[model samples]
Target: MQHYRDDFPILGREVYHRPLVYLDNAATTQKPRCVVEAMTAQYYETNANVHRGVHFLSQRATDLHEGAREAVRRFINARSTAEIVFTRGTTESLNLVASSFGEGFLKAGDEVILSTMEHHSNIVPWQLLRERKGIVLKVIPMDDRGVLDLDAYRALFTDRTRLVSCCHVSNVLGTINPVAEMARIAHDAGAYFLVDGAQSVPHFPVDVQALNCDFLVFSGHKIYGPTGIGVLYGKEALLDKMPPYQGGGEMIARVTFERTTYERLPFKFEAGTPDYVGTHGLAAALDYVSAIGMERIAAHEDDLTRHCMERLSCEIEGIRLFGEAPAKTSVVAFNVGHLHPMDLGTLLDRLGIAIRTGHHCAQPLMARCGVEGMARASFALYNTREEVDTFVDALRRVVRMF
Candidate 1:
């Protein structure tokens, strides 16, 4: 962990006279030096609007930008680069599918299934579709342990069930949903399956084809890449059938006074100027993670997470932990007795410890657990056991205060 910690220069900074302890990884990860350097290199070396210009710099920029798309395709193991579309982030990617796929295939009274553990990005888009298209939004029930009830999910699918959208890994609960099984079930019901991979992609390996999902979306920043860059991977056929998400220069084939046609596959959905530099930085981040190996990262984080839970449970009194599923990522969400999460978070910040405290954008999940909010500490591969120990010692101070 120390070897890779150098890659993230910000990790060395001080907060409130104490070492900065970054536990808000579920929100967004700090960028590695390679990722930032890549962005700088792109801006200095090949800064030009992609696909619009035919000059030397433009062609070079276009190649670099499109090459990033290929990197994304390979990262997710998609069939072709044509299946990948770049967006501002996961929110925009999910919105693209909700708007375009809904208009093309979904009808009035159709059903789109979701889970209680979903981030707001997964929930709101379908709700928008419901308001505009009269579609029914059904939620898959989850147990108190923060795991989804597959029996309830199977029951929710009827003839009207046109799509099933769910998270691969929950941002709040850290529950790793069984997307492969869910995709199989959706396919059996003749429904397309979409996965919000914002949390999962950062933690472990996720092959889009292996999951057998129709669409998958993830943000680059969550995976140590630059912000404002994300990937939306739909099956080529599905993306082709769906209409353009937005309209502008690159998405158009040839504009005529009478009729206009959209560009093919990826560009059809990507309207206006694309984030070429960010995409290049994202590719660099992907390369960095690949060099580290997801399996090794996953194993290291698991040990840290287990240590964190043990320390929090054993060292602290009257604390309640949320999302205790057997299968989960390196996220800890909990609260001490009668202490407001915001207050706890503030105290922790004063101690130079950073953790997220709130409903975690899943109000329904918080409601399900009979709480307003919980403080969360999410671990990344670069995190260390020593840091976890320091965090626990600081938490002890927080408890003593209350």
Candidate 2:
């Protein structure tokens, strides 16, 4: 295993006079020095608008910006750089597909399939589509262990099903979904498959070709990159068929007051002045992860999660852990007796231990688990067994106080 903690400078900092134990990685990760320095260098040394500038600095900035797009393409193993479209984040990426592609293909009688573990980002877009297009929305249920009932999913794929969208990993439950299998089933039924990879991309290796998903979306902030930058990878044929998500400067091939024609695949989706700094930071973050090796990071996070589960199971009294699936990520969602998740989070914060509380943007999962919310301790490459031990100890103390 690598010494992952050395890369993150924030891990060494003190909060409340104690070292910070940041376990809220599923929400957003702390950036390494490399990613921060990369963004700083761009702003301090060579900041310029991309795609339209005639000067040298402008050309350089344009190259760097598009280079980030190619970096994202390689990061996800996309078929081509044209398949990758930059957006603000996963929310915008999914919304783009829903509004542009969904509007084009879906009709009043068509059905869209989703799973019970979807985040609000994944759910809301479809809801909007459902409301506008009169499309029926169906949900695949999950078992008590938080694993998707594949049997239920298999049953839901009728001839009316035109689209199937699900998360690659459950943000609240930590269940790693079988997206490949789902994609195969959707393909068999002639439906488009989309994977919400917000959780999966940061924790595991993702290959769009291997998964055979028609569309995939993920956010940069969760992967140790800057906010306001994300990726949407769609098959070239599909993206070409869909209308442009926005209309502005760069997305246009020709402009006229009477009529206008749109540009090519990726550019059509990326309208307006683009987040050049965010894309540069995303490229730096990708480079940082690549240098460290994603396989190694996955191993470290797996070990950390196993250690946390073992210790928390043995130490905490009156605690209930959710999502006991055989395959899961670094996220551990649990409740500490009668203590509200928010209150427990406050106590943990006093100890300089940061963890996520409440619905975690997955209210449907929370309702299914029969809890108002949960305290989630999600790990990253930088987290350690020692940090897990400290978190377990803090929980025990909090329980005693109650």
Candidate 3:
């Protein structure tokens, strides 16, 4: 992990005249040099529109862009690249399913199940769909430890349940939901299952086939790749049935005054000019992680999580830590006694320690935990044990001042 640290030049830089100890990984990861160079080289050498041009540069750009899609397919172990639809990010991906799938399948009384710990991106889209299509939304409840009750989830599914969407890992709690088992349950009930893998893919290997999810969504920025680029992977059968998410030039097979037909599986979802350079960078990011191995990265982050939790609990008095699920990842959310998380986070930032504060785009999770917000310190593969120690020590000093 320490060897890999050099690949991120931002980690070597200082903040507020102190060494930066970045722990806001649940938000986004720092890009590796390889990813940056890949994007730069793509722009320098092959700057052209993809998919329609016959020129050499256009062909090269299209190849690289589609190659990045293949890279994503391999990374997630999807059956084919046809199942992969490039989107703006996880939000758009989820919205794609909500809109297209909603329009194609969902009816007025149809029900969709979600979880209490889902990010707002997952929640809001469905809510919007419910407003438009009159679909009903159900929630899977989690215990105080941030663990979703399997029995409750099992009981929530009715015959009318058309879809079940959940985050693979909670952004706030870091609880790794049993998505594979959940997918099995959803299938048994004849409902499509979608996994929001924004947090999971960067930390662990995600196989869409193995999970048996009908759809999977994740963002590039969360995985050491560029922003404004992500993926929506749906089973080809389902994608073939669903309508296009947006109407634009590339997604059309033929345009006419009276009628029009849509293109194939992925391009139907990808409406406009795709982010070719971002795709190249995303491929570089995925390739970088693949070379390192996801298992190794998971192990490294696990150690960092355990170390940070132990240190925080031992060093700080009356500190209430959240998300104590047995199956969890590197995020630790907590608040010191009688201390506002925003204030604590502000002070920590001055000490060159970066951590996320506030509701973390999961206000429902915050409300469920009975707090307005929590300070979250999330670890990444490039993080080190020493940085965790620094963050904990700085947090302690900040607590003492109160």
Q: Which candidate is the best by lDDT?
A: 3
Q: List all candidate RMSDs to the true structure.
A: 0.8, 1.0, 0.6
**Taking the tens digit of each residue's C-alpha lDDT, what string does model 3 give over 191-308?**
9999999999999989999999999999999999999999999999999999888898899999999999999878988888999999999999999999999999999999999998
> How do all models score by TM-score?
0.99, 0.98, 0.99
Q: Given candidate 3, what's the lDDT at residue 125?
A: 95
Computed on alpha carbons, the lDDT of every model, listed in order, comes to 0.92, 0.92, 0.94
Output the worst ten-in-a-row residue range by lDDT, candidate 1: 294-303
Ranking by TM-score: 3, 1, 2
Q: What residue pairs clash in candidate 2, if any at all?
A: none
User: How far does residue 359 in candidate 2 sit from its true spot (Å)?
Assistant: 0.7
Candidate 2 lDDT tens digits, 1-402: 436677788888998999999999999999988899999999988799998999988899988998999999999999799999999999999999999988779989899999999999999998998889899999999999999999989999888999999999999888999999999999999999999999999988999999999999999999999998999999999999998888889999999999999998789999999999899999999998888889988888989988988888888998899988999979999997889999999999999999999999899888898898999999998888888999999989988999
Question: Model 1: per-residue lDDT, tens digit, 354-397?
Answer: 99998999998888999999999999988999999999999888
Clashing residue pairs, candidate 3? none
Cα displacement (Å) at residue 40, model 1: 0.8
